[model samples]
Target chain A: MKPSISCKFNRFDLLLSLFVVLAAAALALFFLSHAGGEAGEVSIRDGDNAPYSLTLDAPRRVQLADGHITLVIERGGVYVEYADCPTQDCVRTGKITRTGESIVCLPNRVVVTLEGAGEFDAVTG
Target chain B: MKRTLAALFLTLLLCSCGAPREPESVQFFAMDTLMTITCTEEDLDAVHHAMREIARLDALLSRTREESAVSALNRGETVEDAELAALLTRAAKLCKATGGAFDVTVAPVVSAWGFTADEYRVPTQEEITALLTHVGAGGIGSDGEVTTLAEGVSVDLGGIGKGYASDCAARVFKEENVSGALAALGGNIYAHGTKSDGSPWRVAVRDPFDGSAYVGALSLTDAFAVTSGGYERYFESGGKTYHHIIDPATGYPAESGLASVTVVCGEGLLADALSTALYVMGEAKAIEFYRTFEEPFDMILVTQDGRVVLTEGAAALWDTSVAEHSYQYETINKL
Candidate 1:
C-alpha cells in the first residue's frame, strides 16, 4: 500500500518547515522597517518657494536667491559653498553628512536639511 | 499543514502593511531659526494656525524688526500691547526666580559682544562694565496695562521668544483639538502627544562636543524641552572662544564648567529660560536650584569633564544606549 502524504511527514518535519517560514518573515520585516541608510535625500527650501529635493547619490551645485547663495552636494555630504547673506552662518555650518543635520541661512531664509531614516523625531540642542 | 503555514505568512505581511501613516510636516523660517511642525494629516489646518500664531508672536517679540513691539520698547517707548506686557511680567518673574541669572535686560551686554548683529567681537572690560549697568530685570516695570524700560535699559526677548512661540503653537494645537503634534522652534521643542502609533516622540540631544552626533535621546510625550549651550553660537578672538550666552554677574561668556544644559518642563517658557539660567549657574548651583525650585522640572547637564548628568526625572525618560560616545552617566535625585 502507498503511504499517505501526511504519513511521510513527522511532527519535527512540520515544525522545521514552520520555523523556516517564520524566520524568513522576520528578516523581511526587519529590512522593510530599516530600509533607508546613509543614502537619503537633501531637501532645500529657498525662501517662500516650495522645498525641492536632490538625491545624495548625485553630485551637483544648487544656486538660490538669484545666485547669491550656492549649495554643493558631493561625496554623500552637503554644504553651503558660498552665500552672500550677511551672517554667513550657512557657510559656517560646514558640511552636513548625517541624517537630520541641517544648514540654515537665516538672512536668506534658506534651509537645507538632510532627510533620511533617522531614529528620532526631532533633535534638540 | 503547508496551507496553514502559508496563511500565517500572509497574515504577518498584512500586519506589517497596516502600520500607521506618516504625519504631515511643515517647515518654515521664523524667529531667526528653522521651525518645523508635524501632526496627523487631518490636523494639518492646526499646523498652519500654529505657524500663523508663531508669526504673530515674532512680530510682537522680534528685537530686530524696527516695527516690533520689542524694538519699540527697546527704544524706550511705553508699549500698550497686553500680550507683550504679560510676557514681560512673566520674564521678570523668571529672572527674579533664577536670581537674575536669566535676566532679559542682558541685551546691552549681548549687543556689545555683537551676537545680535552677527558681527562677533570681544568687547573690552570697560565696555562690558558699561553695558552691565543697563542689565537687570528690576529695570523693567509693567503695570498690567503698560510696560516701560528704565533709562538706558533695553530688553531682548531672544532667549525666551522661541520658547514663547512654542507655547503659542501648543495653544493653537489644543484649540484645534489636535490628536498629536511636534513643534520644533529651533532648540525649543514641544512634543504635543504620542505618535500616531501611540509611541512617545523620541528627541535627540545634540552632543555639545560633536555637532554630527547626539549624546542621547529623550522619549517624550506632551512635554517641552529646551537646550542651551555655547556651541550654538560662538566666535574665536585672540586665542579664546566666546559664546553667545553671557554671565549676568561678570558680563562675559558664562564659564560655568558646563558644556551644555538641557531643561525639560511642562511649560515652554520656563524650559527655555531655565536652560539658559542653569547653563550660567554651572553644575552645583543648577542641582541646588532644581531641588529648591517650586515647580517640577528635569534637567540634563553635560559637563566640561565629559559627563552626562541627568536628574532623576530626566533619567526616567532618557535612553543613552544609542549615544554616539560613551560618557559617564550620573543621575541626581532630589535632596
Candidate 2:
C-alpha cells in the first residue's frame, strides 16, 4: 500500500501550529509589559491674545510667548512666570500641575492641568 | 491558513475583552489624628509632613500661644522666621479682606473669654471690654520681613489654622503628583481633583448641635470648605452660650442667625477667612459679600432655625438625608 497524502500533510500541520502558538505567547507577554508601564501626558494652554501660545512640560522648557505676554511652563506645572499685567496675581498664584488644578491668569486666560497617571486599571474590563 | 487566522482573531478578541486594572485606595493623617490618604505613597508622606509643619505653625501662631512667635511679637520683640513672615502676611490680608472680621489679633479677647490654653472661667464683660483695647490687626505693621506688634496686641491663627493646614496638605499632594485628595482638619475640609471613581469629592457638614448627625453633604472639586459653627469652643454661663467666631467690632460673639456658616474657596486660608467673614456679616450681608468677590466660590448657610441655604454651584449636591428638615436655599446668582 502507498502512503496517503493525508498522513504527509498532518506532520507538516503540527509543526506550523506549534510555531503559531509560540508567536502568540511572545506577543501577549510584550503587550502586557507595555500596558503596565504606560504614563499619562497633560497639556497646558495659555488662553490670551491673538495666536495664543501653549507650553508643554512633560519634557522641559523656559519662557514661551505668542504676542501679548511671555508664559513659562517648567517641570510639570505652568505659571505666568513673567507678565506685563498689573497685580501679578497670576505669578503670585505660583505653579499648578495636578488634574483639575490650574493657575488661571484671568487677565491672560491660561489654564494648566496635571494629567492623571494610569490610563486604565486591570479591574475595568 | 483560514483556520489559523480565525483562531488568532478569536484570541485577540478574548484578550481585549478581559478586565483592566483597578486603582488602589490610598490613605494618610491630618485633622489632629490618623487620616487615611486615598492617594499615592509619596503624596501620603508629603501630606503627612505638611500637616506636621502646619501644626508647628499653629503652635507658633495660636491664640493660646505661650511660646509661639506671635507671642513674641505681642511682647514687642522682633523675630526672623520664614513661616512667621508668611503667616503674618496672610493674617494681615485676611484682616483687610474680612474688614477685621477674621482678625488674628483677637487673641486677647479669646483668652479673656476662657477659650485659650487655660480654658479658665468666663470673664466679666468689663474684662472683655478692657482687653479689646489692644486687640486689632492694625496694631501690627510690617515692612517686608520686619513685623512689629503695637504694645499688647497678640496674634492667633486658630480661627484659620486648620484651614491653613488643609491648604498646606493640598499643596503637597499636588506637588507630589497626587491625582485627588481630601484633607479634613477638624471642621475645616479641603478637596482637590475628581475621585478615583471620576466623581468630585463629596463632603458632609456635621450638625452643630449633634455631633453624630450631619446636616448635609456638599460636593465640590478643587475647593476648600470650612464651617464656623456656634458649637465650636464655647462656654455657657447664666444660660447664655459664648462661642468662637467673635465679632471684632463689637468684641462679642457674632450674633448671626445661622448655626453654621460654610465657605468654599480654592485654598483653606480663604475658606477660613470667608467662613469667619460670613458668620460676622450675617445672612443678608453674607449673600452680598459672596457676590462681591471676583473669584468663583460657594457657601452653605445653616440657620439657627434648621433651614439650609446653599450657594448656586453647591446647591446641586445637597443630600436630602443629611439636610433633613432643611429647606433648599436659592443663590444670589440664580436670582
- Give the top-scoring candidate (TM-score): 1
- The CA lDDT of each predicted structure is 0.88, 0.63
lDDT value, residue A11 of candidate 2:
54
Q: How big an interface RMSD has model 1?
A: 3.2
How would you encode candidate 2's per-residue C-alpha lDDT over A1-125 as one tens digit per residue? 99766545585577666766676676667666554432234344554433333434344443433444545555555555676654344565455553323343444454443444322110000
**Superposing every Cα of model 2 onto the true structure, what RMSD results?**
19.1
Q: In candidate 1 chain B, what residue range of length 10 has the lowest lDDT sum?
A: B11-20
Clash pairs of candidate 1? none
Q: What TM-score, to 2 decimals, does candidate 2 have?
A: 0.64
Residue-level lDDT of model 1, residues B175-270, one tens digit each, is 889989989998799999888888998899999998778899999999999999998888888999899999999999999999999999898998
DockQ of 2: 0.02
Per-candidate RMSD vs. true structure? 3.5, 19.1
